[model samples]
Structure formats: C-alpha cells, structure tokens
Target chain A: MDNLKTKHFTFQLKDLEISVELIEELARIDDSMPEYSRFLKEEIDSTLSLSQIEGGYTILPAQLDQNTIHIGDHCFNVGKSIANKFTNSTHIAIFTCTTGPLISDRLKELNSQGLILEAYLIDLLGSVMVEKAMDKLQAIIEAECTSKGVNITNRYSPGYMNWDVKEQKDLFAFLPENFCGIKLNESCLMTPVKSVSGFIGIGEKVRFIKHACQSCNSTNCLYRNSKNHC
Target chain B: MEKLFEQLAYCIEFGKINKQSPYPPNMKDQEGAGELTGQLLDQGVSADDILQKALIVGMERVGVKFRENKVFVPQVLMSAKAMDAAMIQLKPHFANNPGSQKGTFIIGTVEGDLHDIGKNLVSMMVEGNGYEVIDLGTNVKAEVFIEAAEKNPKAVIGLSALLTTTMNNMEKITIAIKKHNKNTTVCVGGAPVNQEFCERIGADNYSPDPQGTVEFLNRTVA
Candidate 1:
C-alpha cells in the first residue's frame, strides 16, 4: 500500500480521434446509406465537441486466491470468468473513465425534441468515445508496465462476464473518492451515463487476451456483439 | 386505394418522411408517408385501414429485417420516424375510435435502472404494430406497473432492465405484478435478461428483440 500510487489523466476531444469507420460499423451504417452515414458523422462531431474525457487508475499489489482477488485489505469476489483470466496476476490496476455529462444532457434534449434518431446516434457516439478514452488510458498503463517488463491482461469490469455488479463497490474502494468525477449510485450504476470502470491485471505471467467474448456467457452483452467493430 | 397503401408502406419501410425527406435516395422527391397518409385520409380511406394496411405492413417488414440483422437500430429508428409521421395524420381518428388499436401495452424499465434506449425501441415497435402503448419511462417501480395494469385490465405488461443488479428489481416487479393479478401476462426483456431468468422470475415471456415481443403480442392478443 505504501508504494501504490494513483495517476489521473484528462484528455481533450482531439486526443480520442474516434474514427468514423468504427462508428459506422458499430451503428451498422455504411456508405451505401449516405443519408444516415452523413447524419452520424454530423452527430459524432457535435458529440465530440461537447465531450470532456477524463480517466485514471491506481495500481495496487494484489493476490489471487481462487475467485477472490485480495487488494490491500479488500477482497473482491470478481467471479470465475475474470478470476481465471487473472490467475497469474501479481498486481491490479483499478481504473475509471468518463465522457462527462454534456453528451448525456444533449441526448436528453434531443430526445425531448423528438429527435430520437439523432439522440440514438449521439448515445452510440458517446459509448464509442468513452471506450476510446479507456483504450488510450490502457495504452498508457501498458507502456508504463512495458518499461518495467511486466505484462497486462485484458481489462475486466464488475458488471460483465458473470461477475456480480455489486462488486463495483469493492472495486471503487481502491480508487479515491469520485475518481474521474464518476459516482456509483446505490444500484452501482455510474453517473454521467457514459462512464466505464474496471480492473486490468499487471504482472510478468499475465497475458492480454484480445477476445474474451468467446469464453464469456453473457451473450446479450453490447460489447460482445460489437467487439469485432471495437 | 391498394396502390396508395402499397406506396405508403414502401415509404414507411424505407423511412421517407415527406417529399422533402432525402432518405432512400431512390425515393427522393416522391411523396412519403406524411403526404400519402394525408392523401389517403382526404380520399375517404379510414384511419384504421391506413394503420392496418400500410403502417403495420411497413413496420412489420422493418421489424423482420431487424430480427434478421439486415437492419439495425438507426434504420429501425428511421422507420419509426416515418411511422410517426403517418400516425400523426391519423391521431384524431384514433382518439375518436378508441377501439381501433389492436390492444394495449404497458412498458417500463424496472426500478433502479435508468437505461431506456432498449425500452424506447420496444415501445416504438409495439406502437407501430397498432398497440396502444403506455410508457412508464425509466426507474419505474412495481406499484406503478401494477397500477397501470389495473387501469388497462387487458393490457400486456412489459418490464425492462439493462443492469445485472437491477435484474433483481425486475424479478421483484414481476412477482408483485403477478401477485396483484394472477392472470395478468408479464413479458421481460433487456441486455442481461434471458429465457431462464424470465422463467425463474415467473415472467410469462421473454423476447431478445423488439420483433419477438411484437410476435408474442400478436400471438397472445390477436
């Protein structure tokens, strides 16, 4: 605990150059539908203009005993799916990232105005942006670990892969109060709506798996359905 | 009249809102659902016919395409918008003829869940299919659903929850609705919900997509 350090990062909209191609693939639109493709591009630009991305992670010494991950004095029952992936992990990076509240506020406004299509496109863009920001954060963590000759595993969130979402409380305990300006409600849902939080394993024996969807049983997962595009 | 209905259905399927709507570039400058519906009404076609013969046909095609993965959310939303444009012209008729709807549907996201995109999509699809929809919005409680069900005695109740944690709330809501009225039909859906969870919670049905829900309602109520 004495050597553990928390690092925070703020990214401008320019930092996350979310590609239009990726957005189209996720939204299932293509150049053939030029009208919708153009609409999505416009909304993406507007959403990015309103987005304020922020993220941070705190690396802590961890010990895995079966399905339980012991970090400091807290133990997270992160379920078998995640525990199996982190079996060789010697440390864990707890992270949180958000695309601020403006995009959500704009979505509400669009919905109120009966622009459901535009609002839906913006919502999809927000999801893509926040995940892109997390990807950037992960790259930073990876580079730092690479410098130290430590490998990282694929990130896991509390709500996915059969892991009990209630463990979000335990996961948040590793971060400072309101880390990245994200707050968990009683139901463990993050506010600002487009925020994401999770853990990434760090150690020499840990390995990053590109597609965890094959082993995961949560078939209705949005990420699983869009992982190819992601 | 049949030609007009076919044209209107095509407009709804391709998402042509009006003569000015630039979608489905091939249909550009042609009168869309908005114009065609108005013409049908002025030509003495019944609102019920427009809904039954045109709007529902168009929406059903879109729903099937969505189920088959030939179309996605944005495309479906465009179709919904076109449906809305046509439905707007028939609003007065529906108001005067309350029994014109196929049936009533009550839907909401369970308590502790604020996600509504999936719920909204379901609502649009159901409404487009001629059901009178009563949307309870997000973070709705069991009592609210029971109350709405009590008012619309024959309405089918639909519960949605996007979070694994709120899946418990969906179960609690389902149990409460069933306890209030043992005969009431309850349908549950969401990203985290499935057939097993639906059966475990005693929910009457589970649909992975909006089309399945529409098909279930068609089978159950029709």
Candidate 2:
C-alpha cells in the first residue's frame, strides 16, 4: 500500500480563518491534561488547525532567477540547508492544498474522540493541504521549467539547518497578505496548523536532496521539529 | 454471533467510534463500538473475550491497513478512537484479570520533535493489543527514555520521528538507551524511518506500523 497518493483538490485559500472557540476548547483540554508539558502542544495544535482553515499559509508560482520558482510562506520549512540547497539548484514541485469541503466534517467527527483528536485532525488537515498544494506547485514548476529547457531535480524547503527560518518573512514578502493568510508568530511559524514554506529546484541534472533518509543528519540540528519518520 | 463480531470489526476498522460520529457516513447512526461492546458485556461476554476476540482483532487489522497505506491517518484515527471508546468500558476487566498484558512498552517522539500523531497511533495500537504503554509525549530527550526504561526494567522502547531533521535524534536516543540498558529493545517508525535506518541506528527492531510493533512485542513477551 502506497501511503503517498496523488490527491487533487481545489480550495479557495481566502476562506480559511482562526477559530476562537477552538483555542478555548484546546485550553480547556490543556487544563485537564495529564501531562503538563504537553499542554502547550495541545494549545498550539488547536490554534494551528483553526489558522489553517482561516487561510493564512500558502505557496505561489513566480519567475525567479531565470527559473520557474515555487514560493511558499508561513508554511513548514523542514530546514534551512534544504531550503538553500533548493534555491541553488533546480527542481519542479506542485504547490496546492486539499480543495474539498469535507475537512470540517472530518474534523467534527474527530473532535468527538477527544480534544487531542481535534488537534490531530487539524494538524493532519494542514499537512494534507500542504501536500496537495505542493503537488499543484510542482505541476506549475514542471511546465515552466520544461519550457525553459531546464529539467527539474527535486524539492526542498526552509526550516532545515543553514536555511534561516527568519527568512520566512522574506519568502512571503512578495505576496499579498503574507501569502494566503498564514502569518509568522513571534518564533516565525505559520499560525495555521497546516502550512508550509519551501521551494522546488528545477535543473537539467538530477539532484535529489540528500536530506531525506539516512543521508541527512536530522538528529544534530537545533531547529528540528516533529519527531516523525519522514 | 460471528456477524456481530464482523460488524464490530468493521466499526473499529473504519473508525466508527460511536453512533454520533459522522465520519464514514455509511455507518452514520448505526450501533457503534461503544454501544456494541457495552451490549456484549451486559450480555455476559467476558471482558477478556471482548478484548482479545473483538477490540484487539479490529485494531490489529486497522494497524496493518495503516502500515500498508490501505488507510491513512484520518481512517486509522477513527479506528483508534473506536477502540479507545470500547476500552473505556473494559479497563476494570483488565485490572480484575491478571497476566493479560504482553509487557511494558515505552514510546515517545524523539527530542526536538513535537509531532505526536504517529506516536499516538502506535500507543493506542500497543495498548489495544494488551500492552501497558508509557507514552512520554513528544520532544522527549534521550535521558527521559532512559529514565522510563530504568523504572520499567523489562520495558521495550519505541522511537518516532516525523521530520527529516528529527530523525537524527532517533539515533542519539537509541544510543543513549542502549548505553544504559543493552537489553532494552528499541523500535523505530514514522514517515522517514525504515528497517535499514533501524539497523544503522543499532536499534533492535523497526516496524512499519503499530500492528508490526504489537507482533514484535508479543513475540518478545512470549
């Protein structure tokens, strides 16, 4: 079974917003949490999901540096090095989000399980949306790069080591409303539970970012986020 | 009858937590696992019978589906939720009945990583399979795991990483756990980890999904 499937959805990015009740609900969950340390996480997750629906984080296609470039802001940047490496190279990535209305229903059902369910659904929604957005962004990048005689290599994003996350501000500088409503918190993270920031490299040579799998060093990085396999 | 068990498994597998849950609309308003399990218990079915015979069976199937990508997080979360709801009614039976657990399992998202969906899924699956789970939560340090292992001397450890960057911490924590207790079994999973990476980190096992983890734990305890 392939965990990765090609999902296409056309969503109106402007329709997303932060839900105040979600924050309160998350806070209520926090107060009852068995583990105090995880309180902040529960709250952040709730806030992120609400933010994602509010439409703050987004990506766009633009002509950058004589290349068809994909730009994202207020979304997740895995690392700085990965982001820089993409900028210096060429690859095609599709930037899109889940375009269906089933998210609210899905989230509602998940919420019945517990507050953590709400937070999780929101996070999953954000990630799924980001993945979908990336797919759309990839198609645009590929079409643009192909016409320019540049074969795409691979995709990369910010938040990786060596790629300053502070650039999140700069990455969104060109977009109106900071690229679809996703704004930087004080720490430079997207407010929406599901958002991402990155770029796709388009070039003639095949340059897969060495950061994925064992070839990359994730353990040593100070800015590491999410204890996940991917 | 076996039909009820089949229906119960479908509820757990599709994530039909209860009648009120609106997901997977086909099951909407139907008798959910909560009601069914409660009904089964009220009918004099042993709690152990329900757990091993129904809840565990349902959860195990979903875990494999999740690992194989036949189902995604949303679907699996529903299954876990269904299993959890059913477990709430069966906790007393677990306590009343001894020698039911496979063993203790300590799980957490590695240090510097904050994601918990994958880890939580594993926790529910392990718990559903009759293992006592100590979930350390996310952003856990190597020392935290070691501390847990020290407390539960017979416990096995599972490490989860969602980001490429955080996967690095898996090795460090594995090394630390092994350093303190060489006998400690370490298993790793997440989007970026695999068996090859597991061996490279010197961890004892790597399972692609929660069911795999359950099977491994069962073997060890057996």
Candidate 3:
C-alpha cells in the first residue's frame, strides 16, 4: 500500500462563483415567477457573503475485488454500481466538503421565526453553495491529476446509488478528526448539515462522466435536474 | 358573503397575506386572506364555514398544484403563510368550538433521521386542511409516536425519513407503533420512501408528496 497524504483547502465564498441563475436552475424556478426570481437574486448575494467553504481529500492506493474496494487495510463493500465504475481505478480520492455552519444556522433561525419560505430558499442556497464548492475542489483535484496523466472518474457518495450510508464511517477513517470541520454522527449524517463526502477514482484509464444522474436511482435528489437527466 | 369567501380563497391560493403583502404581484394592494377572513367573520360567517369554504379550498388548490409540479416548495409555503394569517383570525372561534377540526394527526421524522422539511410540509398541509396536527418534531422515536397515538386514539400517524439508512429506523418505528396499537393508521413519506417500502414496513399508507399524504389522511378520516 502506498503511503496516504491528505490535502486540505479553504475557500472564499467568491471562489465558487455561484450565480443566482445557477441557484434558480437548481431550485427549478423560472422567469414566470418574478417574485421568486427577484427573491433569489436578492438572497443569493447575502447568503453567499456569509458562507465559509472548506474541503479536503486523501488519496490512497486501492484495488477492486469484485464489488468490494480494498483501500489500504480497510475494505469497502461499495456495491456493484460503484465498483463497476471504479474498475479502472488505481487510486481512490476520499473527500469531504462543507459550506460551514453559518448558512445552516441562518436557516434554523429563519425557521424558528416562522419564516418558512425564506428558510427554504436559504436551505436550497446552502445546497447549491456546498456543491459548487465541491465542484471547485474537484476541479483542483482533476487539474493536479491531469498533470500526472492520471484521469479521474465522477464522484460518488455513500448514501446515493445504493451505497450503504453506514460506510461513511469507513470513508471518514481516511481523514483526521473533523476534517474540514465536518463531523459524522453515528447515523452517518454529517454535521454543518451542508456538507458532502465522497470518493473519486484516479487512474490513467478512469474517465469522468459529465452526466451521471442516469445510473443513479435517487430521483428525489436535490441536485437531480428537472428532467432527471443530469 | 359568497364573494368574500371567493376572495379569501383567491388570496390564499395566490399567497397574499394581507393588503400590505406584495406577493403574486398581480394582486398588489387588494385585501388578502387576513383582511377578507376578518370581514367574513364580522359579517356573521362562522369560522368553520370560512375554513371549509376558503382556507381549506385554497390550500387544496395549492396542494394539487404542488403535486402537479405547477408550483414548488416556496410557493406552497407562501400559501401556508397566507393560511396562517387567516387561521389567526379564526383561532378564538376554534378555541371556543374544539370539535370543528376534521380530526387529529400526529407526525414526525423517524428516529435517526433529523431532516424535517418533508415532515413540516405535511404538517402544514394537514393543518391547513382543518386537522388538528400534533407535530413531534424531528428525530422522534417509536415511543414518542406511541405516546402521541395513545393520547389521541383516533389520530393518524405520519412518519418521515429523508435518508435511506434511516428507512430502517422508520420500519422499526412503524412496527413499534403497530405493536402498541394495531388500529393506529400509519402513513410514511420522505424523499427516500415509496409505497413499496411503506407496505414492507407495515405502514398503512405512503405518499410521495404532501398532497398525497393529505389525501390519505382525508380518506382515513372519511
């Protein structure tokens, strides 16, 4: 097994370059709802201003045996869907990303004050922000891997695509305590609530799938597009 | 009086809280659900009539629209806000007559599942439909559900679990509630729950959306 090294990163909210249009698209809002469109435009700026994004990843040598992935001394029974996608992988990038606690705290505050609509919008905004941050982080990882002629596959998380969520503990084992200030509870839920963790396959033959929603069965996923073709 | 009811329903369906609220842009300065509800009560309309003819009718439209994908969460929440405004005017009358509600509903997110957006949406819809809702909040255990069911023997129970892993906990809670009282109607929902899982878990009903849950509850009471 190759020695593993964890890389950490912090980001300014501006680094994600989140746009109101992107949030509107994620929220399934269109030009017809002028009030909501205006509201999204107004809130996106303030919400992004308060966001504190951070992320990190650890690369470990890995081998796939049937449906299970052997990473260092730990074995991840990641299921056929993931194992099939990672067949060409020589290394696994275990990653965690979070939009920090401010957005969620604000959401809770709004909800407590009986501002449900505002809170819901903020909640959607937080999801977009964290995912956008992860996208930026993933791009960094991809760029670094590209320099070494190593390609990366689309990211996959434990709770999606039939992967057992309990395996989040095994995934977290690769990182230090509370890496990126995100903690996993016994139920495998992440704290800060607006955080995401997953794995990316890295190898010469591994390729990124631009639209992975087709293979995923999570139809109600927040990030899933309106057509379910994302 | 009929015109007032129609106007109030329109306000609620469009999510106009009051004359001062600037939503649904077309109805900018018109009297909204709040003012119209007050006027109807002043004109001798019973609170129950206002609820049945206006608020419930409006909320049902919102629910159907939400189910049809004609509207989304924020829009539904706005309608709920308008309903809240109208309900505030009717609260005193409802307090005087406790039997006016359709029935009782007990709801919560299953144990190990902290997500509550789906639960809250169902709660709001059920309440807007004139049911007395007892929300146990998120991460609620089977015992909590059992206790609530025991208190309101006729009440229907709703379980929500947004995580696939917590679906196991939902099944356990459903079994525990059924063990406590086999007659207690259990409805399960969430992003991850479906009719197939609901049947496997022994839940009485499963709804993919809040409107379906409302419809199930309406049928249970009927």
Query: Model 2, which residues run further than 4 Å from truth?
Result: A1-117, A128-230, B1-6, B19-29
lDDT of 2 by residue, A33-150 (tens): 2232343345334433343332222223333343223443333333444544545453334322232333434454554557555556355445544554555555655666678777
Classified by CAPRI criteria, candidate 3 counts as: medium
Q: Compute DockQ for each candidate against the true complex.
A: 0.61, 0.03, 0.51
lDDT of each: 0.88, 0.63, 0.85
Task: Kindly give the number of clashing pairs for every candidate.
Answer: 0, 63, 0
DockQ of 1: 0.61
Model 2 lDDT, residue A96, Cα = 24
**Taking the tens digit of each residue's C-alpha lDDT, what string does model 3 give over B113-194?**
7787889999999999999999999889899999999889999999998887788899999999999889999999998888
Q: Count backbone clashes in candidate 2.
A: 63
> Whose DockQ is higher: candidate 1's or candidate 2's?
1
Q: Report how far residue B75 has shifted in candidate 3, in Å.
A: 1.5
True contacts kept of 3: 0.31
TM-scores across all candidates?
0.93, 0.60, 0.93
lDDT of 1 by residue, B50-90 (tens): 99999999999999998888887878988999999999989
Can you write out model 3's per-residue Cα lDDT over A1-230, one digit (the tens) per residue? 12347888988776677776766666666554435656666666665576668998988899987788998788888899788888799999999999998987887788899988767778888888888889888998999899998999988889777688899999998898878888887678898899999899999998777656667788677776452335
Model 2 misses residue B220 by how many Å?
Answer: 1.8
Minimal lDDT window, size 10, model 1 chain A: A221-230
